[model samples]
Target: MNVAVKAPVSTLIQQAAGRIAPNWPLDKLIAVNPYWQMRQLSMHEVAVNLSWLGGVHVYGDVSHYQHVSDDDLAQALSALGHELTVAQFKQQPLKQPQPWQNVAQLADLERDSEREISWNDEVVHQISQFAGDYFASQPQTGAGCDDFYAAWLDTICHDHGLEILMKSKGLVEQFKALPSDATTLVEQALTMLGVTDEAQVDYLHALLLSINGWASYSAYVGWQAMLAGKQNNVVEQLLAVRLAWELVLWQQLSSSELQINWKRQLAHSNQLKGEHQAYVDGLQVWHLANEMQIQQGLHQQLRTPLPAKDNAALSLQAVFCIDTRSEVMRRALEAQSPSIQTKGFAGFFGLPIAYAVGSYQRPQLPGLLAPQLEVREASSGKLATAQYSAQWQKFAKSSAGGFSLVESTGLLYLGGLVKNTLGLGKAKVTEFGPLTLSKQGKALPLSEQADMAAGILGSMGFTDEFADTVLLLGHGSQCQNNPHEAGLDCGACGGQTGEVNVRLLCQLLNDAAVREALIERGIHIPDATTFVPGLHNTTTDEVIVLSGQVPEQIEQWLAGATEQASSERAKLSASPDAKQKARDWSQTRPEWGLANNACFIVADRKRSQHLNLGGRSFLHDYNWANDKDFALLTTILTAPMLVTNWINMQYNASVTDPLKYGAGNKTLHNVVGGNIGVFEGNGGDLRIGLPLQSVHDGQKYMHTPTRLNVYVDAPKHAIRNIIDAHDNVRWLIDNDWLYLYQLRDDGICRYHQGYWHPVQ
Candidate 1:
């Protein structure tokens, strides 16, 4: 049922540019794999092309790939079938463009000429203003993401025509009037600008390269059009304006006699040598080697007896997100007591709901998903009391405003600030609290809740195994002055805290009426078992009780989790002052933020029970035997596996090319539009991915940029059926974005080219 998009080459380029993700607001920050949609091209190919034409360092030359680990080098040589040794690498020519050929030299075409304005600056600024208005005017629930380009094309076509350019060389009329639609506009503008149809793609690439951040941001909104087999008109708007500007600028600089051949220059710039191919091979070898190391390690732990596999009477059972952060906590908790059991599920717990508070609605699920339900926060819980001050809310939100207000108060503010700094002063917030059962208010009807309960239980393979106290745990972080706070939270919850989804699901599952309906559907809950809602603070390493009283033994067991968390934290950083750095507002490195992540296994615990994952694997609880129809496995492959891949590549791109993809030095980042995005140094482009500090240490990268390795303990045919059925899944695996492994009785077998290759 997939629709094919039939378009001209010019339209294709615009659509491709528009498919790139835009950086979200600081509050809704999500990890995005920059090349997810462009998986048709290999990483090296994309990197090389991006660097050559865009002037962006997505991935550097042979020397850049040399940063791979020693083990990775050994693997690269064998897997790549390329000749690369230290001697040969030394002989390799530089992969990047020479100093003279670079586009940077094109800035000042004629030094002697008196130019009143910069064409690039003026066009970019004007376009940025138009883009901002177009996007900000529409809400997510409205047509804002798509209307910018449509409106621009319609308005411009009404006044401007080719006659305006025939009369005046000025860009004012060019901006004011234009052709009726994108195609006519682009064709006419190119004719006037002296750019031929053959060079339009290169021209579009050059223009998009300059304002890549804004273009990418606009593309993020255009995702809806791409999904519907339509081109992103907004990106076309960008292409049109910038292309028109080029025509006007060419007219202005016609007298300069600057011999600028954009097509010829770009053609020479994007060429790759045989040695550069070897360099790309070596980089892949390192990536493959890194992947192999994890697979071998995970395969080694396959036979370890899984806890609570049978219908054992467990004292406590807690379900946590399949995030890599939860893997360690699950292990620590299980080790605390033999009776304690842990299960990994998607943080949203199967209900795709947008978390809303009255008039304010936020996208709290995975940024990729279209929220199907709305869960509102009505009551303030405890914070709604009279003691809460309205001014304190503003103080908590804005640092500059709060500091100025406190400075005006002088001594009165001094005493309070000092007390707050000492951790004694409390400014109660009358907003954003724990979601209770009453607030849930049967969001999912009894039949719907019954259906969801079955899906959740069936996915986890928990049909009859109900514990004394079943805890649904979600995670969130608390930090000051951290713009990427949401990036540190649950990915399954759409970059927001997963506590609300977890609590609501727990309440629905524990309801007597819903349970009775589920029992008829063959899922039975024990009378003695009670479901509790909880949250895990990954930063502070604290487990907070949200609702329903827990047993005293469970409470005591939870209290000891802090010690285990500290032990894990010690392993993460050797520095004793690391904890102190977390409190430091100036510190950019809040946490590793899923660094060194490699494997995503959707199988039982026994597959990775004894191995020291080091918080690098995402463990989703799945029982293949229970999934006879393979629907759950299909969902996991398409949804969680795909989402995990995005997370993997986000870190990979950030580590490989921090200059372009990453938000440059955290110290220099200036918050743009309050919380919408960031600027590296006040102006150039919007900063998209994680800051450099999050991935790299002072010396080298903490995260090894590589593809995610996915291991599934399902029948080979089941895995194969879904992969063959879904083009998206097949594209990712076959395209080498991720590796798929089938867990068999004999050993782990990798799927490749319609055959299963045994893991070496």
Candidate 2:
């Protein structure tokens, strides 16, 4: 046990100090023990650090070491469940008292109050001398001490996860020595299983043949590392990192091959939560469960309460939602709405208005100019003087020629209603008000929209933003293109294709009118449709951004810049055929799909294949040339409609509310005119893997569950109305809705409140 000095022990101690000081005062211990030092440390640094934690408390004073004989020291370590190191026995420190007061004084102080003192050159000199003298009187008996140290190391290593590192190292060495052609087919299978490296091919090939070969190999290496009591390398760290997947896969094969009860193994794995190997253990359980279809029996249950309001005047609660997905908006309402009162106010179009915080809590209304009113005021001799008239002429030039005739009429009505609601007198009525709209038709500004919606909701007594916030909380990706225009619908919601067409814009505006007029007729919408515009960022050499600038300024600047940029771009151009080729390509690729569903009929070979496409690329890749073909695709891709149809088929017509699901008295196939099952797709392809893995001793595997989609085909208006009314409709209150559908098994479907909860 003649230990040779390698690197100065102080160097090793300094490194160890970083790790231990965060938890305890290691620096203070070294400061007092001037004689207890060694030099030329190696990879044994970690071991030395760990060992210090084991016995430093006993070395309180140098004389205290004299009281304990070598045997006593050995016995003390043995009592604490550790073996004395061979190096320590052969090269033991002198059992003599030195400047032990320095150590005593420091230890006596409270842990928090102990201040660290710098180790001067003089202190370093004393420690170096003591380290040499300390190891001068040991015997040359390495075997017994080695055995004791090895045993002690194993115990400590096992407690701190060092055992796994040992196992991984041994496995790597063993695999390197493995013969190349020992198991060709097994290796081929492992390669197919994702073990691609040539170096690992032989090992993996051998690994797959035995169900627990990898696990056993890893465990053996861990045991060896524990015995050696050394720090592990990179390869040795694999057990804790990927051990779970290996364990799970191994268990999966074992239970399948040997017919063993793996449930106990799965449960036991969960207890190893703090262990580095826990992930491996969990993976094993997860993989086995997937193979057994553990989630198939679990069901989702839904419940919708009846509507009840506190105030009669504001008895009906309406939610205005503007999302690209109207169906999701509808589903959200239905899932959360109560039975008695339905949420209302589902509309999208409105005149653009800017909002600014006004005096008091009430918003100020801006009035529109009516030529008739202006003439009357002039005739009544209320006209301004010559100085005012000169200023008024300038103002009139900047006012966009007052408001449109139609807008003036709408504004007059809106202003009167708002004035009456606010209890404002005519004397306070100014030329400007909140209800005024921009002469050019466009959706209201975002701030104005939020404020107006808030006002409308305020009148109903819902002063909190929670409900309105919920109405706005839908999924969307951020778009930053076209600072002035937002990309809305784009055929997604049966609306306009783009800003290029004024017809589509007019359609949207007219629809807004229809909705506003509906409210005027006392037909309040409880579920409001929300409009969300997607944004895109377009950057080109000629492009220049003037964010927050007025629209007029942008147009004026662009008018001058466009001509120059166009001329410059025209200079570096391709042949005319190249342009024609692009144009031809664009014409071949149509943007719209049949029935406004965004599905397309591409003439792949003139038979005209139809695809049920809606989102982005559905038109190009999948579309239908005929209505019948489109219906087939709809049956497969849209689950909402498919599930609805299935309910219609399985139920008796007389009992249920047919209108709720858009079903008639006829059977599902009769109503739709055909039976289709192509939408189910293969179960394996549709499965989304469960987010868990399992491992045993150190192995893992993954698991997944199958999910399906359903599609429906309906007109735009009908679909919008359906989505709007969904929140209040009680799809469950009628027993006939459930019984007729024969959906008793809380298995395939579960009824929580009012809608069908599809089990995944």
Number of the top candidate by lDDT? 1
Tell me the tens digit of each residue's lDDT in model 1 across 1-760: 1122234646655554644555555667788887775676665666545654454444433444554465655555657675677446435455444322222235345432353344445455556655655555555432334445457555444534323533334544545555545566666655554444444455566577666667767666566444334555566667666666555545444543343454455344324333334344444554555556656666676644544444545899998888888877888787778788889888878876776654566655776777766776456544445225434543443433445556688888667555654556553321244343222445456687688778877887679888879898988765555667778888788777877887777777778898899889998899888888788877656677777689889888887765686578666664434445544455567677688888898887766766668788999988888777989999999898888988998897787767667888877766655555677765666778888888877677777766788889998989998999998788788877788998766678889658889876
> Please, what are the lDDT tens digits per residue for candidate 2 over residues 346-407?
12212222221221110011111011100011122323453365354323221121222225
RMSD to truth, every model:
5.6, 33.5
Tell me each candidate's TM-score.
Answer: 0.85, 0.17
RMSD of 2: 33.5
Candidate-wise lDDT, in order: 0.67, 0.23
Q: Which stretches of candidate 2 lie over 4 Å from their true place?
A: 1-164, 167-169, 174-637, 641-760
Counted clashes in each candidate structure: 7, 86
User: Which 10-residue span in candidate 2 carries the lowest summed lDDT?
Assistant: 22-31
